[model samples]
Target: MIYVIIGILILAASFIWMEIAERRIQEWEKEK
Candidate 1:
């Protein structure tokens, strides 16, 4: 269960960061 929780946490962070990076890229594109 601990391993599962850890995996989920990592997966959530990966997705959240992916979204943040994507939005930042979009904003950068708009600035160009």
Candidate 2:
């Protein structure tokens, strides 16, 4: 059960990181 919880947290963090990276890329494109 503890391992399952850790897995879920990691998934959530990766998703959030991806979203932030996407937004940064969009902003960079707009500047160009």
Candidate 3:
């Protein structure tokens, strides 16, 4: 049960990171 919860948290973190990275890339492109 602990491992499952940990896995979910990691997945959520990865998705958030992915969204942040995408926004940064979009801003960089606009600057360019």
Number of clashing pairs per prediction, in order: 0, 0, 0
- Which pairs, if any, clash in model 3? none
What TM-score against the true fold does each predicted structure earn? Answer: 0.87, 0.85, 0.93
**Cα miss at 14, model 1 (Å)?**
0.4
Give lDDT: candidate 2, residue 30.
100
Q: lDDT (CA) for every model shown?
A: 1.00, 1.00, 1.00
Candidate 2: worst-modelled 10 consecutive residues by lDDT: 1-10
**TM-score of candidate 3 on Cα atoms, chains taken together:** 0.93
lDDT of 2 by residue, 1-32 (tens): 99999999999999999999999999999999
TM-score of 1: 0.87
Across 1-32, the per-residue lDDT of candidate 3 in tens digits comes to: 99999999999999999999999999999999
Which portions of model 2 miss their true places by more than 4 Å?
none
- Residue 1 Cα positional deviation in candidate 3, in Å, after optimal superposition: 0.7
Better of 1 and 3 by TM-score: 3
